[model samples]
Target chain A: MDLDSQEQILKLSELHGPSQLMVIIGAPDPEAAEITAETVVQGDPSYAGVLAGAQLGLDVYHVLDESISSEVPPEVWDAQIGVMGDVLEADALVAAVAGMRQPGSDSS
Target chain B: MLEGRYVIALGERDGISGPAIAACAEAAGAKVVFVATECFV
Candidate 1:
C-alpha cells in the first residue's frame, strides 16, 4: 500500500468504528465491488461505514484495515436493518432466500 | 410450502465465495451488499 492509500484507509477505519467487519471479496469480480459501492452510495450509515472502508477505487488494495487503525481510535459500527439483513457493517452480502412463510419467522 | 428467505453463500474464513451474495443483494433491493448466514452440515 502507498501513502495515499494508507491515509484513506485510516480515515475510513476511524469512521467504521469497532466490531470488525469481515468483507468477503466473492469471486474476484469488479461487479461485486461496484455493488458494494452502490450500496454505500444509497444505503444509510449501518452499511455505509464498513462499505466505505472497503471501497477499492480501482484495486482491492484500496481498503481500510488494521495497518491504518494504529493511527486512529477504534469506533463502533452502528448496524442498521437495511431492506433486509444487508448491513452496512457487512458490505459483502450473503442472503438465504426463504419464502414468505417458514417454521419460525415473521412474514406479516 | 413457502420459499422463505433465499440462502446465499459466503465463503469460509470471512473470505469471498461465489456470486450468490451479490445476486442476493440485488434481489433483496441491496444497493451495496446483503448478508445471509446459514449452516449446512
Candidate 2:
C-alpha cells in the first residue's frame, strides 16, 4: 500500500476500529492482491509506509472475490470490470487475498 | 453483502481502477470513504 493510503487506513481504524472497516482491492495479479491484503491484515510487508507493523487486522477482500462479485450488479460489473476478468487470473487473485484472511494461515 | 459498511478501495491502475472498485462498492450499498489507484509493479 502507498503511504497516503496507509495513513488513511490508520486514521480510519483509529476513528472507527478495524472491525468497522473493510478494504477492497482491485489488483490484477495474485502477488499484488496478497501484498495489499497483508498490508491491511498483518501490516505492510515492505515496511515503507504508515501501515508498516500496524497489524490492523482489518477485513479485506478482492474485488473479484465471489462474495463481492455476486453482490455487484451485472451491468456495472460488465461495464467496469468485465474486461479485466478475461485478462487476469481471477481465481489466483481471489485465493491470494483469501489466504491472508484465514486465521493462522502462513501468508507471511 | 456490504450494505452499510465503510469501504476503502485500492486498485491497480491497469486493471480495476480505484473509481471502478468504488462504484462496485457503492452498488453494494457500502459507503466508500477513499479510493486510490496505483501501479503495483
Candidate 3:
C-alpha cells in the first residue's frame, strides 16, 4: 500500500520471525466470516495444507470474527481478504502460491 | 509441558510437532492454539 504501511509490515515481519503467518478474512456477516476461516483452517487443502504442499515452512493462522478485531491491522486485513478470496476461488496449487506470495510482498 | 499457560505453537504441516505441542500443552494444563503451514489431507 503506502510506503509507511509497507515499512511497518516489513518491520513487523522481521520482528516476528518467519515461523508465523496470519491471514484475516472479512465477510458481509460474522457467520460467513467464521465459515470462511473454518474453511481455510479445516478444508482438505486448507491454508496450512497448501503451504505445506508448497514447502513454505511457515505456520498459517486464520483470523475471523472477534479474532480479526483483536489480531489484524486494518490495512493488512483488507489485503488478506483480497488475496484469500482469489485463493479460495482458484485452483489449489496456483492459489496457494499466490496466497503465500501476497503476504510476503504486502506484509512480510 | 506448559502448565497454566496460553500456548500458541507455530509448526510445519508436514511434521508432527504441531500436534505434539498441542498434546503437551493439554497435558500441562495449558490452553493451546496451533497454527501450521500445512496439514495432512
Candidate 4:
C-alpha cells in the first residue's frame, strides 16, 4: 500500500503571517476558509504548518473580518472549523494586562 | 513582478470605481486580487 501522501499537503507562507495587528473589514466564510486551506494544501505541502489540525491565529484572521460587522456577515464561519470564533490578539492583550496586575509584578 | 504588502485605495464614488481596482492591482503586480461586491459577505 503506497499512499504517497507527500504531495497532498500545501503551504501559503507568503499569504500567511501578515502583521498580526492588521485590521480589515471583510466577511467571515468557513467554507471559503476550508477552500483556501485546501488550496494551500494542494498548492504547497508545508501549508500544514500554517494551518494544521487547528488553524493558527493568522489563518483565522484571513478567513473573515468582523471589525466591520455592520458592513459584513456576522457569521460566515459560524460552525465548521470554528476559526472565526476566536481572536488571539485580544486574548494576548488581556493576558499581558492581567500579568501587570499580578503580585510578582515582573515588569513596570 | 511584485512582492510585499500592497494597499488598494479606491474612491467609494461609482464613476471612478470601474478601473480603480485594475489600476491598483497592476501597479502592485499581484497575480490576482480577489474582488466581489460584498453587499453581504
Candidate 5:
C-alpha cells in the first residue's frame, strides 16, 4: 500500500477504532488481493510503507468475496463488478482474501 | 451486514477501480471514508 493510503487507514483506525473499519480490496488477482489484505489485517508484508509492522488487525474483504458481494444488491453488483468478475479468477481472488481473515484457511 | 460500517476501498486501476467499489459499498449502506484505485503490478 502507498504511504498516503496507509496514513489514512491509520488515522481512521485511531479515530474510529479498527472494529468499526473495513478495508475492501478489488485487485484483479489472488496474489495482489492477499498482499493488500495482509497489509491491512496483519501488517505490510513488504515493509515498504507506513503500514510496515503496524498490525492494525482491521477487517478486510475482497469486492468479489461472497460475504461482501452477497450484501450488495444484485443489480448494483452486476453494474459495478460483474464484468471483471466474469474475466478474473473470481474464486481464487475471493478465497485468497478470505483466508487472511481466518486462522486455519488454506489459500496457498 | 455492512449497514453503518465505515469502509476504505482499494481497487485495481485496470479492473474494478476505486469509484466502482465505493459505489457498491454505498449501496450496501457503508460509509466510505476513502477510495484509491492503484496499479498492483
Candidate 6:
C-alpha cells in the first residue's frame, strides 16, 4: 500500500484499545467490501502491529444481496444465514449501507 | 464509548448508504473491522 493508505490504517488502529474486535457487513461489490476489510485487518495492531504485545482482529463479511431493495439475490439467503452466524459470535455488529435510496425515489 | 469494542456493518455497495453507515459507526467510536455488501447486479 501507499504511504497515505498506511497512514489511514494507523489512525484507524488507534481507535481500538485492547480486547476489541469489530465485524462489518455490507453487499453489492465484493471488491469494495474487501477494501474496507483490509483497512481494518491491515491497520490493526494485532494484525499489523510490529510491536510485541497482542492485537485485536477485525472480521469482514460481504453479502451478495441488496438489503435496501425488495428483490433478493439468488445466493443472498444462504449468505445471510452464514453472516448471521458470524454476527452472533462477534463482540459487536455494524450495518454499513452505503446508498439506501430506493428505486424511483426523488433525489431532491 | 466504542473503544475496544467490536462492530458489525451491513449495507449496499451501489451508493453512499453503506459506507456512510460505516463512517458513522467509526465516528461513534466503534471500530469497523468487517464489511459485507449485497450485489447490485
**Candidate 3's residue-wise lDDT over B1-41, tens digit each?**
13443434432332223444344334535455432333334
Worst-scoring 10-residue span by lDDT in model 5 chain B: B32-41
RMSD list, candidates in order? 18.5, 3.5, 16.1, 14.6, 3.6, 14.0
**Model 6 alpha-carbon drift over 4 Å, by segment:** A1-9, A23-27, A43-57, A63-108, B1-16, B19-41
lDDT of 1 by residue, A9-74 (tens): 334434543122222233222344344333322321234343444432221111122221222222
Candidate 6 local Cα displacement, residue B16, angstroms: 6.8
Worst 10 residues of 1 chain B by lDDT: B1-10
Q: In candidate 4, what are the lDDT values of residues A30-64, reduced to their tens digit?
A: 33223333332233223444233422222112212
lDDT score of residue B5 within candidate 1? 26
* lDDT of candidate 3 over A5-61, digit per residue (tens): 223323433455434433332222333333333333333233333222233222233
Candidate 6 per-residue lDDT over residues B1-41, each given as its tens digit: 34445555545544324454455455545556644444445
RMSD of 6: 14.0
Which stretches of candidate 5 lie above 4 Å from their native place?
A: A102-108
Ranking by lDDT: 2, 5, 6, 3, 1, 4
Off by over 4 Å in 4: A1-15, A20-108, B1-19, B39-41
The residue pairs in collision within model 4 are A9-A45, A10-A41, A10-A44, A10-A45, A10-A47, A11-A44, A11-A47
For model 6, how does the per-residue alpha-carbon lDDT over A2-49 read when each residue is reduced to its tens digit? 233334334444665323544444433334544444444444233334
Q: What is the lDDT of residue A2 in candidate 4?
A: 8
lDDT of 5 at B24: 95
Tens-digit per-residue lDDT, B1-41, candidate 2: 57888888998897789999999989988899889999845
Candidate 4 chain B, poorest ten consecutive residues by summed lDDT: B9-18
Compute DockQ for each candidate against the true complex: 0.07, 0.60, 0.03, 0.05, 0.59, 0.17
List A-chain TM-scores for all predictions.
Answer: 0.20, 0.89, 0.27, 0.19, 0.88, 0.30
Report the lDDT tens digits of candidate 2 across residue range A1-108. Answer: 789999998998888776667888999878889999999999999999988998888888889888898888899889889878878888998899988985642221
Error of 5 at A35 (Å): 0.6
Q: Which should have the higher DockQ, number 2 or number 4?
A: 2
Interface RMSD after interface superposition, each candidate:
16.7, 4.6, 15.6, 15.2, 4.7, 13.2
Model 2: residues >4 Å from true position, as ranges? A103-108
> Model 5, B1-41: lDDT tens per residue?
57888999999897689999999999999999999989746
